[model samples]
Target: MTKSTIKVAALSAAIVTALAGCNSDSGSNNVTERPTIAECKTYEPTQPVIVKGDNQDLNFQTITIGATGDMHGRIFAYDYALDDVDVNAGFTKISTLLHEERAQNDNFLMIDLGDTFQGNSAELFNPLPIHPVVETMNHMEYDVWVPGNHEFDFDRDFLFRNLEGFNGAVISSNIIWHENAVDCKNTGQETPFLRGYQIFDYNGAKVAVIGLTPSHVSSWNASNPDNFRNLDFKEEFESLENTVDEVIAQYQPDVVIGALHHGRSETHGVVGVNEIASKMADKFDVIFMGHEHARFIEQIDLGAAFENGMDDITVSGDKANQVEDKAKSGTYNWRNRDSKVKVIEPGNWGWALAKAEIDLFKDQDGNWKIYDTTLSNRTVADVEEDAALQSEMQHVHDKSVEVANEVIGKIVGNFTNTSNGGADEAVLEEQVLNSEGQRLYTTIHSAKVSDMPLTDLINQIQIMYVEEKGSEAIKEQIKVDVSAAALFSDASNLFNGDTYRRKDSANLYMYDNQLVAVNITGENLKAYMEWSYRYFNTYQYGDITVSFDPEVASFNYDIFDGDIEYVVDLSQEAGNRIEITSISGSDFDKTATYVLAINDYRFGSTMLVEGWVTEEDKIWDSSNETIYAIRDMLTEYVGLNDLYRTEFENVNWYIKQYGPSDAKGNVADEDKGEILQLREDGGEGQDLWERLQNKEICVMRSGPGARDSINVSVNVDNNNTWFVNPNASNPYEGCTYSNQPK
Candidate 1:
């Protein structure tokens, strides 16, 4: 028998022993019980068995492939930032389910769809030759690995080191060497940085797996060109098509799989995995997707339906359906596209594993052809973590925990209280740190919506860093006039007392974003503010609650400080939300230029994409300094000044039309008293304001807030016909805005 056959036979025999362990209820023995992998009691296949051919021959084998994506470095069932045990998901938990699946299948192969080694506690191990994420994968014996966009978040050398440390075959067909790189020895522009695909021969049956990373890595990481200094990530579709054709021609594989590190839904105008799988249904048998952090199994129809179907469908002629038309139809199912392809994503953070079982049979022509395929996500919610793996990774976990608990500085006050004109103090939800009465207070509502000390602290730090430690050229040219920052986490907070740990700082500023100072035109600055305000949905009549647009990411919304004053009009649509009153306390100028402080991510994803600026816009970047991470800078700043004080007053920007407006939904100066009274009154007014703050009510009006008697609409029991007068003593006369139990 061949080596593949021998391995299959051994794995097949192990199934009996695995089943015995799973079915064991023996209670006679009193010996010490070792840590064991959990049986898959909740492992019910979600998708039905898909069969393509009929063959009842002995020359058939079932190959099981397991996958995980966008892990974001959750190797252990613990949150290092939170400094608590997170029993939800981890590689240790996933290992249990993986072991169970491997024992059941005759042949097994494991793959991680990339985005490992970057989030939370994962970066703590970056200095090591083998990162904890790669170490865990190596321990699991992963067969193939792909690179995600975040893999390029660090320096080139760190990424290369981890990739080299992995035992698995690293692959990304789209990544190639840049021609002008000094380090380009044998790898010129045409040479791929890693293997494009890996062919696995199982008993002479070849299975080809092609890997593709996000094509927008260059744009995403443009802030630090050195991160991907010698690499070029080609477009996904062309690269995938070329690689698939080459793999088929060279290997003549019986089965083809796509290990793609792209989301299912299109983002930033990039083609999503769903669309790619649909367009290439005839070429690939299975495709695993990542980066969206979702778990699902979906299939698409082939040939006629695949080409002619609407909404993410590809067509050939004049009668073809348009994607825009389908979008306008308002019934397009983006989750499950109408095409001939099998796509699966196993979520993120080691919560679930993507599994694809392919049953191959020797056809009449003496060639191996796939007969049956099944795709599903195996969740590890009910499974116990692999004790052996957890033990091995114990040192890393302990170090992370130690780092998390280490006191970085002393913070005596809160960082989320409002100062300009709203709530005097943020409603604090006290969290007990330990039995010693140490505490941290988390804000009940998102500080991103309004001016708060937390975000102001970030903006202040950026301006301070650039002015004091900026390049000599930047100091000579101009000082930072404005700075913008986003509250990455809603739970961001400082200690209520005098003790602040490293975790507290991490909770406030999570990512490893570097500080950047850029020269921006007044026109572009206003436009940038408008784009950031797109996070809020336009206010409507009877909208008792303020809401955000689902399409816009919350992190993209930034708060401006340092010599700028603006008002965000929620009543106005995007591109028209920001009403800048002044710059440096003077009249706003649209033609003038000013220095703006921001993170590198904003410089790439926003400023560059919007055509507001280019690489030449940058005056200074922290990547050239001693510390690059914004989180680390904040920590250092906090350490230098032990007392946590609001360095800058939260008066730069505030929101308009986020509360109860006048009868016509207008913000009349005369109605200010009534509005505040209504919000303060313990009756309908207070109810309205609280509901709006809590996001429990949405009141929609018929027209602009200028009418004296505007019609307000509120949804009541699936009905949107409820109308009322906003100026009336009981503006909610006909509208029951509250959906809560009375």
Candidate 2:
């Protein structure tokens, strides 16, 4: 082919490529071939994007995106010791880095993905005044912000109030406020309270940033019925696709990016960064994801992503096989490279900043086209703290510490997250044991009775509250058992001291799990314990540790109390692994039915394993929607007793099978085995996961006066409204609202 002939063929291919990318279509192979309109114009491009570039032209412009999310109100620096070297992070450090980045690049956009206005001791109060985090972001001049899942952790009214308080534009494409939802100052209508997307005309590029919140919002906010009841969240993938198609037709942006509060993984039907890249990555240029509180820069190839069921493939032929871009780094597509979807997530708590650098050039037709890119995160520890920012936020910090220190109660002993002294660290160190044997001796499973403090305190408060608040008949006839998720279950602890402050309360509970009571047969109770124990991988002999499945959050694993003693047989499969050793200090009774005190989460949560609490099992409900209702109740209980020392109690229940057993199902290990009574095995845990893991824990009940002092709502959310079939292993119910009065 002559140079002139080759130029013509190349020009034709470039025009088709630019047009295909802008309109989100698969371009044709042969320049002479006239592809069907359906193939190239199913969704009209923003139009006017120049399609005249040859294969060797320089990009028109370069744009840099500096984004952060999951701030969690860390307006001030937090302390930690690294190799005995103290390090800290706060908005002050973030501001310094951000300023430096913006100064270096003129074409820059600053964004916050979400999870602000909550996380600190102050957020638990929902101050009548504005939060410092919002003000600091405003001062920093953020260009855009997307509300994350934690933003809904506040009261029903605080949801939009905080979002509106942001200094920059806020958008969410999938959230539609319910008609009777709590009234906030909502004037926007396309998707009530949330604008879909914003288009920026910058440096000759029409870049569009569309916002998206996770689709499982309802699941996470179920405990806060007042807030969740009025919000309609559509599936992420569908909502994102429709929004992208609409934005393309309306704005014809040179590049499109997604600002989503979702994360990298494919969580059910939610369309997160991974989902977008695999199915719609070629459609949108870049995505900033939040929610998992992790940090990483990765790419997704649509053609390759489809192998994992990420269907739609728009980029085709040679373009699909193009070499991976410089800006796109890491192997996250389960280690495949077949398409182009770039995603960024900065760590939470102002720990790092994700800077995504990309270059773009318009085709001869004047449309912007992104060609290459690179990304990296700057840790706050590496950057100098901004003095001015620190000074500005100092007052906020002082005020929080003041409010947190207000004494609320007294404690006798420190509640720590450490496991039972791990086989005497000194003794274990003297002997070089095998890895498996070390695990067997040091690891303390959640089932051990000694590991029961955190759960015991919360459950005690729950049972006591139900006793005092239930109807006189209920108080007289019903014996209550408490089910707590162990607030400080992992490595968190509540310090023991002469006096406890509000900060202790804040530390004690991290979720808005309201108090709830329900009825369960002793048989289902066994099933519940079985389900809880299923989380732990079977204890292996000669192992230093027992690990649980992370996919199944520890928060979902409830620790039951109130005179019931059960032995967990991890060797058995789920649904039948619980062995009821004793009940109320007597032989286990399969026929006994008991009134159970629980958080609204576990009572109505869809994350409950196999066959547990059916919607019909829920009976009593709390009027107040306090996130830390258990803590508040505990404070009241302590006040009633007028304690001056620690009030947390040791649970009476004991685990029968703690370590590995023999070939006959009996615990044979010389270590803490079956009946590894308290003090022998690791004592009660220091903490739980701190907050609800399964956003699906949103199953909530009666609002305000829906019930009186009895804590039982004759008129309430139906207890029988879960799982359409109620018998299915994995439940999927769309309509969760059940307002019919009992």
Global Cα lDDT for candidate 1: 0.65
Worst 10 residues of 2 by lDDT: 685-694
- Our tally of clashes for model 1 stands at 13
Model 2 residue 280 CA deviation (Å) reads 1.6
What is the C-alpha lDDT profile of model 2 across 379-473, one tens digit per residue? 66556777877776665565566645655555655343233322222122111112111111122223332444555677777776666665442
- TM-score for each predicted model, relative to the true structure: 0.76, 0.69
Model 2: lDDT of residue 264: 63
Top model by TM-score, which number? 1
* Cα displacement (Å) at residue 101, model 1: 1.1
Model 2, residue 42: distance off in Å is 28
* Model 2 stretches with alpha carbons more than 4 Å out: 1-59, 79-88, 179-193, 265-273, 303-338, 413-449, 470-478, 489-491, 494-499, 521-528, 573-576, 583-593, 603-617, 623-628, 636-671, 674-742
